[model samples]
Target chain A: MTQRWKLTIEYDGRPFVGWQRQDNGLSVQGCLEEAVRRFSGEAATVHAAGRTDAGVHALAMVASLDLEKQCRPDTVRDALNHHLRPHPVSVLSAEPMAEDFHARFSCRGRSYLYRIVNRRAPLALEAGRAWQVSVPLDAEAMQEAAQRLVGRHDFTSFRASLCQAKDPVKTLDRLDVERVGEEIRVTTAARSFLHHQVRNMVGTLKLVGEGKWAADAVTAALEARDRAKAGPTAPADGLYFTGAWY
Target chain B: MTQRWKLTIEYDGRPFVGWQRQDNGLSVQGCLEEAVRRFSGEAATVHAAGRTDAGVHALAMVASLDLEKQCRPDTVRDALNHHLRPHPVSVLSAEPMAEDFHARFSCRGRSYLYRIVNRRAPLALEAGRAWQVSVPLDAEAMQEAAQRLVGRHDFTSFRASLCQAKDPVKTLDRLDVERVGEEIRVTTAARSFLHHQVRNMVGTLKLVGEGKWAADAVTAALEARDRAKAGPTAPADGLYFTGAWY
Candidate 1:
């Protein structure tokens, strides 16, 4: 009997082309699928909750796959981790799931975190993990601006032009901006997001943080309903897919 | 005419042989010295508060150097950082210092942080940055054991045999262990440390953290006055040269 399993995973996204399997280079999904094939002797495809862009990390991404081999939860987790080694991807836990459960379609919510190192010096330890913004940022101003985007709204101005989502409306649950020492962190949650919504919102808020735009400017950008009205998209290095709620 | 400058630096030590210059691979000191040569046309050596081993990292390492070129503090800091590009090193700040000030000899305190990822999964985001101990760790036991190493004592057991310090007896100002989420953090401060002192102590504490030894075992190991009586030296990956006080 085939068993469906849900896997919680973490990875450093620098090496992968992105979460989706592409012909150009390595992807996190491709790596996990290879590990699964090696362990189960089946060419099963693993599905993730989100298709993160290139250089986007994941703290606890959930994925689902079917396996023909019968194994305990611990054995599945350890075996996948062992085979995935040398690559910076880890399966944190594996659990049996009902056949109806799905990693993407059945997901209820998603959360993300973005880190900005606000300093004049170049980063050494956190170079690839965080975005280094040499300009001093007023995190309080960013926090004030972030509140403007915190409810049900059409986010076309913040969404990527290439986004395939049929609808532009998404309910944002949370959008928090805070400063911890030299790093400014932005965290957000939503039932779903149009592609690049988080990064675009962060980039727009950054202008407010730098005092180049007033806090109310974000409202104007959102009301414009045009992608060009919003600020530039932030780099993918700073974005992380934190978790998903079923 | 020479200007004495005190520089605060941050480095990812994985690419370096160590903090000191050596004939082997690249060294952090050698890179700084070369940066100084490129920036100021001087071959002056840079001295650091601690000589971190390979694979170690630094958050705010203090250093001292003499520059014959007269420049503003910001210029020196910025220029040195510009030249140290492509290497995982950065000059965080440069300040004018009195000739009496020295990074090594005049330092009054040194602090270190050791990170342990106490989880079954192999680390992905923190792979090279933290030590992964698959066995569940008892952080409370580790904390109590760590207290035994605090205070003035002959720490020969924790000291590396090749340490050149004349006296093993030194007062440890702090040796605090605490659990932060999945990480077991060991923070310690002292006027100075014997070579590999922090790593050795952390290794010993791991035994207690694993329930393999009682907390009182630390006392016996300290009293033994022999390095062999202590646990094996922990890997340099988890150790960070946090800061130094003048």
Candidate 2:
């Protein structure tokens, strides 16, 4: 009998091309699938809650796969981790899932964290982990601007040119920005997202935080519903897929 | 007339070899000194509160140099940051110091923070920023055990063999181990420390937290004054020079 499994994987996105498999480079899913195949001798197809873009990281990314194996959950976790050691991918948890549990299709919500170090100095320990902005930012202004984007809207202005969303309309449940010391964090949650919507929004928010754009500019950008109207897309280095609800 | 200047510098230690200049690679001191020379057309010696090792990071690292240049503090900060940008170093603040001020010799205390991620998850964003421990740790027990090594002692058990401390008898003002979620933080404060002292103490405490060694074992190890008596030294990646007192 085939058993479905749910896995929570964590990875440093620097080494891998991205979460999806590509002919030219390595990917988190490809690593996990290969580990699964090596351990169970079955070619398993893994589905993830979010197919994170290249250079985007994750602390707790959910995935599901099916295999015809009698091994315990611990065995699966250990075997995958062993094989994945050569790669940056790590399997944090493994558990038997109901047949109906689907990693992508069943995921009800997703949350992401964007980190920015606000200081005159460049990042050291947080070099790749955060967006370092030497110029001072008004996080309160960013928060106020973020509140304007926390609702259902056609986010074409925030969508990437290559984003393959069936529709540009998405419901953003939350978009909150807060500052801690010299770091400003942008936390976002939504049931679903249009392609590059979060990053594009963050990029525009940066302009607001830097006092380059007023809060009303954000509302006008949304109303424009054109990608060219938004600010530059933020770098992928600071984006993190923190969790997904199933 | 020459003036003594105190510089509060910040740098990303990843690119440079270390705080001290060496023939093999770039150093933080070399970058700052080079910038001073470029600004004043004269070579300057830069002294830091601590000579950090390669790949080790610091925040609020204090340094001092003598300069005869006629410029405002903000001018020096901006000029150095501009020149040091090519070197990943930044001068956060610059001020006139007492003629007798010495960056290292005048420091009264130094504090360091060691981060340990007590989990099986592979680090993506925090890859080089923290040490990961797969084994479950009893943080409270570790905290209780860390106290055993507090106060003044020879600390030879935790001192590295390569350490150059003339005398192992140093007063430890505080040693604290606490848990913040999945991270176990070990904070140490002392007037000065032998090489690898903090890492060594943390390594020994891990044994107590893992149940491999008891709290009494740490006290015995200190009394033994034997390097082999304590646990292995923790990795340097988790260590951070948090602050220094002048």
TM-scores of the models, in the given order? 0.99, 0.92
TM-score of chain B of each: 0.99, 0.95
lDDT (tens digit, per residue) of candidate 2 on B115-209? 99998766655666688998999999999998888788998998989888799998999999899999999888999998889889989999999
Fnat, model by model in order, equals 0.92, 0.44
Best by lDDT: 1
For every prediction, compared with the true complex, DockQ reads 0.92, 0.47
Q: For residues A138-175, could you state the per-residue lDDT of candidate 2 as single tens digits?
A: 99999999988988998989999998878889899999
Q: In candidate 2, which residue ranges exceed 4 Å CA deviation?
A: B9-18, B23-27, B30-42, B68-91
Candidate 2, residue B228: how far the Cα is off, in Å = 2.8
DockQ of candidate 2, scored on C-alphas against the true complex (2 decimals): 0.47
